[model samples]
Target chain A: MFRIAIEMLLYDKTKYIGLLIGVAFTAFLVTFAMGYFAGFMTRGFALVSENPSAKVWVMDPSVSSAEATINMSDSALDIVRGVKGVNYAAPMYLGNMTARYANGDFQTFQAIGVDDATLSGAPKPANLLRIPESAIVDSGGTEGKLQTPIYKKDMWSYDGSHLNAPTRKLRYGDTMLINSKRVVVAGVSHTIPRFPPRPLLYTTASNFKRLVPGEKRYITFIMVRPTKNITPNKLAKRIAKQTGLKAITSDEFKKETVLWYMINSEDVGDMVNMVILAMLVGFGVTGVMLYMFTYENIKQYAVLKAMGASTKQLSDMIFTQVFISAIIGSGIGVGIAAILAHMVSSATFPFRMMWFAPLIGFLGVIIVSMTAAFISLRPIKKMEPGIVFKL
Target chain B: MSKIISTCRDIVKNFNSGEAEVKALQGITLDVYENELLMLVGPSGCGKTTFVSVLSGLLSFDSGVCKLMGEDISTMSDERLTAFRGKNIGFVFQAFNLLPSLSAIENVALPLTVEKRKRVETLTLSKEMLEAVGLDGKENVKPSGLSGGEQQRVAIARALVHNPKFIICDEPTSSLDHKSGQIVMELLTEIIKEKGASMIVVTHDNRIYKYADRIVHMEDGRIVKVAS
Candidate 1:
């Protein structure tokens, strides 16, 4: 009976191929859309997430997410460092600066100013201190997420693929103007994009102060690492009480950022819409194609039924075809999405590929195929086995 | 004297399409014994097909005692009746009814496949049956690739592949030429004798009446004449 199901599916080459294509299309569309949305989730907390050194973040009392908050007083850095469980607190200048490239292209970037003494909240590779006039430009900016190909004056462009290709390494002398102040590129940091999709620039706190002169309250997020034997949650509560500010653990802050983006970002809603629409398209294709194919083969089912095939046997045949198609179609869809994730990530569009995103798409195909087969079974059940004697 | 394999006593069946009700089978009483070929012949709408449907458990009788090997198929559940039919009955159709996508042997192996037979064994037996029907080298040919006579030969191979105790063929040779019709009848009758199986064949192909152990004629919705 299983063999009959498979052979019958393969019997009509046109219908079989059509069914496969419909399933594959469903898989591909759903996976790619959800993957792109997953990328948005990464972008929502790009700033605080990359700096793993910071265990707790202090923000305005009313601020729920990272970007939605007002700037903190520069003196808040000292106030947070005085908390009981605090090991060290750093003042992070989270502000945007207009960068004029050597090629005269002006772009906006998340200009992050790290603590000059401890350099507490800056991200890897910890060598920004080695280069003179040192600053790192974010390379993970593409698809209008930020600047395209953050180029340096002397270094060759990094437009190639794979390990053997030339790396996007920056030379010591390549410089860009930050508000007309000379700022040189020492390295490039690959960070998950920001909510507003801005490129990132990492510089010392003094350089940030020089670049954006005379901002009265330059400090934005007060990043703190808790001392050993103290969890970030306890420290956050204490800091919130003592400082009269909102202090949250890193995970809570990340969750708040994600939730804030989910509610406020129109792009997130649009991405979600694409996922829903793709599912409908997939279901539509699968349902209509299977219905037409089964209708054409209804008589064949009648003949088989008359020849002593039970309803279970016939149903198994149809479902077997559907199950096989679902597996193969999902494989094709996830495979393409994975490949696209790799390619688009290099160019710095936030295309994220989680293991479960494709699984969701796979489940979608299964539901679609099963429902379609169920709808098709109505005709199979209603068919009279005695009709085999006619025609 | 052969043992009785199937018995249908005064079976009644009707079909209703809107307000008009047609008596498709009216008081059909018949008996098919082991190792016998019982042929039912009649004009269009004469209840021959309907009677055979009732006997094979493909259709329900309003009131009658219809039994296959004394199992009382008329009283069996739909699942039980279908299982019984798969185990004890095989059918060949007038149009050959071969799935267009499958090759000759695949169609022949279908009945056994439905019964959950092993693939290798089913295919091997199907090949043997196709060869028995003189379709030896054409095992992989689709029904469309075969002649009308060859298609009917494949249908016969399918019918016997499960080795059912009783075979029902509705006009199995009516669409074949005279020579092909004679060949099909000979193959069916010889295989029945070889296996000691009972057969109920409904046909209007008088050219092959010589092959029947007994011939029953139907008219309107009742058996009018039986010729032995």
Candidate 2:
């Protein structure tokens, strides 16, 4: 019976190719859309995902997501480092700052400052750094010469007193004014998985304090690493109790990132809607094509019925044909989607394929193809054996 | 006389088109006995197909009862009638109604498979039936690959594979050439005798009348004559 169904599906390759293409395109659209959505969400929380040293992040109790918090204190770090599980704890700062170029162009940039002794959340260094005044700028972030000055000759400045620009050219050993104080660029770093947005600059916590000008005791957030026996969640609870603040693990932070995107990000919802709509269109096209195929073969179905085939036999055969189409089409579709994702990633598009999305898409195609078959079953089930004998 | 495998008494079938009702079969009484080859000869619009459909439990009569193996077909629900038909009857049609997707042997094995017979056993039996119909090496060939005569032989093999108590052939050879038609008629006759199963063949072609153990002629939905 399965053989027969497969043969029937293959019998009209030209006709079914159209249906297969419809299903394939639908699968590709669904998978690609989902991949883009996931990529976008990851970008929204790249800071947390890329953090390597922080086993637990202490944040404001009311903060639902990583980006929603305003609470930061050195008091929380002192207490967390004193816990039994804590091996080392350091302050981490995150805030939005405006960077003005020599052309007077301003862009909002996320500023991250970590202790020079323990750079837990800092960007991975591609070049050597030996000075505390020296900073690393993401080379991909700004358009400037390797060692030439692009900005004004004067030292750069920020609105807050915590940050200081040491140099105008932003090269090694060049001084720019950051918050009335001067700092230097030590080295440059390249891209990493889930890197922060372009035009990002990294500097030391001492330089950051010059721009903000608060009690040097306060930090934006705390980073902690557990000892062998200390679990992140347990340490987080201990810290929360001691400092009256919230401590969240990296996994918990990731979840909070996803939650934040789901609540605040409109692109995620739009992508989901688009995927669903594409699937519906795929089902509709396949259904119409399959219906026409069945309609063309109506006489054949009647003939089989006249030959003593039960209704169940006919239904199973048609369903099998639909199943075959979906399997083949989805396989081809996912293959194309994977290739496209890889190729497009090198370009400007932020496309990342989560292995699970294609699997879900494959299952989605099966369900949609079955739905197409179900729509065509009405004509098959109604086929009268008497029609075969009619003159 | 052999046992009466199927009997229909005063069966009436009517079709309703909006408010108008057309009578297709009226007051038709028939008895099909085992081991008998009954041929129903009639003109177009004479309700031959309708009578056979009703007898096969494929359609219901407006009035009167149909009994197959002494079970009331008319009173049985569609589901029960279907089950009963699958077990007790085989059918061959004018168009050589073989499932084109299935190979010759697979087509012949359809009934056994529908009966939920074991796969290996059904295939073995189907191969034997195909060999009996002189399609020995062609079992794996699909219907489209075979000639008209070969396809009809496969159809005959399918009908007889289950060894049902009764067989129904409606214009079984109408689409075949004269020689192929004669061959099919001979094969039907031989199988009917070998299995002791009753067969009712409805056809306008009178060339194969000698193959019938009994011939029933019909006109205007009533039996005009029964010749033995």
* Candidate 1 local Cα displacement, residue B139, angstroms: 4.6
List residue ranges in candidate 2 displaced over 4 A: A6-11, A14-27, A126-134, A139-186, A192-198, A214-218, A283-332, A345-349, A366-391, B1-3, B20-22, B77-79, B118-125, B206-228
Least accurate 10 contiguous residues by lDDT in model 2 chain B: B77-86
Using DockQ as the measure, the top candidate is 1
DockQ, candidate 2, vs. native dimer = 0.32
The number of the candidate with the highest TM-score is: 2
DockQ of 1: 0.53
Clashes of 2: 24
Candidate 2, residues A223-258: lDDT per residue as tens digits?
788887978999888888887877888888878878
- Estimate TM-scores for all models: 0.79, 0.83
Q: Local error of candidate 2 at B28, Å? A: 2.9
Provide the lDDT at A366 for model 1. 85
The alpha-carbon lDDT assigned to residue B2 of candidate 2 equals 77
Model 2: reference contacts kept, as a fraction = 0.32
